[model samples]
Target: MTSAPLEPFAVTIDFATGALVPDPDVLDRRLADLDGYFVADIDDPGVGAYTVHEVRVPPTGNNLLSSTTVLAPGKVGDEYFFTKGHFHAIRDRAEIYLTLSGEGLLVMALEDGRTVTKEMRPGIANYVPGHWAHRSVNTGTTPLVFYAVYIGDAGYDYATIAERGFPVIVVEGEEGPEVRPNPRYVAS
Candidate 1:
């Protein structure tokens, strides 16, 4: 027996609100959810950090997966709010992020401890190559919104990132957001 074919559908992105019309399930991350991901402890861990809405799809074949991440602007000890970075479980699966509103940075790191950062702003699309662990940091005073697309089977390997940490971090500086080496990084 064979399964039915997947149907194509359309979804609208409300750029101003950073919402997906028709409403996809949202994953909310509070500071509490990011325990060791930051450099300092927050007085209120229950404070909202970021939210993610992903269009669910089968994790197979060439089907593309799409998601929207809206990172709230704030910080803990000068370190900006950020997503918990991850490498694709498949290792060779690449992804692209298109900034819709606000400003931020796309920080990517290689296993060799090398790192690079891409400025994220409206109209800019950053390509994250395979094997790079990537994270997004909200550097502006408003929510940083972006849409990401990647292969369906490009499962996330957050454990490696949680265990080893990224080589660099984004922090608020007198000149604005700055990228600095993470003293706690453990090369994998």
Candidate 2:
């Protein structure tokens, strides 16, 4: 009896041709940067309200390619605030949030400047559509923890985020107050 010849199962897409391929080693190394608990100061404007550590993922020497590990608004203690904004670049893929632990509030800003807020607890799955602007804040008494899983590169230029200025934030306060992006929070 004769056996049939083996066929190629490999397939490729033009869009993914020049994209930066994220490797496991690079991802693990980059993610290692954020290895501790972070705190945000609510009353101080000079100091950044959010604490962020980055996982550095170098580009694969490809054009139209970029990737990085960002630990933003992950764990919150008692109180926290996230400024409202949106990404100008329309992401072709959807973004997901994996709740590791804790609880917080999710805020979405509309094009017309209108904002919507939701109460979020642990085990809650959050999905943000491409190009959708959103933010999260911790309102619970305990620290809120979660993982942000962003898939598909959307240029990595968060255009929707405020460059510099006081952003809109809704919280349980005596008077409605505006919140600004923490100075320490750096996006790479």
Candidate 3:
């Protein structure tokens, strides 16, 4: 396999809303009908709520798989829209996320029961070590966007999160979005 160029790709697209992200192949994720354990009873938002655009690269040359995450602005009841948090299937593979635009928070849950959250804005980068399950929450009124890179073989274990929800949920607050303990969450 030919090695991919490390040089920057000229393709430009708005990361916040994925203005020009390739279509017919985008992988979308939605929280409208999740078990409703972390959110409230609500109408389905369908599958267009959020999307993952896989960046084209040499499939056999690089060990890293890159993607741009476009999270829509809205609410699942009082809770903000968020990524379905996951721990890498490889267990020892880490991931990195850099904010492109908009505002949000990256919430991370550890097996040790500790939860950490970081505010996101343009140019901010969050490094998630192995063994942590992380989710991204859109706290602002606009779309939340970011770039992420993780080991190609890492694989996401979303089922574990579905079984064991995050201990905290981001909700609208008087000043801004707040992170509060999830009433329905039971730590595993």
Candidate 1 scores a C-alpha RMSD against the true structure in Å of: 1.3
How far residue 168's Cα lies from its native spot in candidate 1, in Å, is 0.7
Q: How are the candidates ranked when ordered by TM-score, highest leading?
A: 1, 3, 2
TM accuracy, model 3: 0.84
Least accurate stretch of 10 residues (summed lDDT) in model 3? 16-25
lDDT of 1 by residue, 58-113 (tens): 87746899988999999989999999999999998999999999999999998898
Listed in order, each prediction's TM-score against the native is 0.96, 0.48, 0.84
lDDT of each: 0.90, 0.40, 0.78
Question: Could you tell me the TM-score of candidate 1?
Answer: 0.96
- Report how far residue 72 has shifted in candidate 2, in Å: 10
Look at candidate 3 and tell me the lDDT of residue 99. Answer: 87
> What residue pairs are clashing in model 1?
none
Candidate 2 residue-wise lDDT, 134-186, digit = tens = 66665554444444545434434344354421134434454522243334333
The candidate scoring highest on TM-score is: 1
Ranking by lDDT: 1, 3, 2
What is the per-residue lDDT of model 3 for residues 1-188, given as tens digits with 9 covering 90 to 100?
Answer: 35455766534567656544454347766655454545687567574467877876543324677878888888877888888888888777888999897899999998666899999888898999998899999888788889888877788788877876898899998898899988877676
Candidate 2 regions with alpha-carbon error over 4 angstroms: 1-48, 53-80, 83-88, 156-159, 163-168, 173-188
Error of 1 at 45 (Å): 0.7
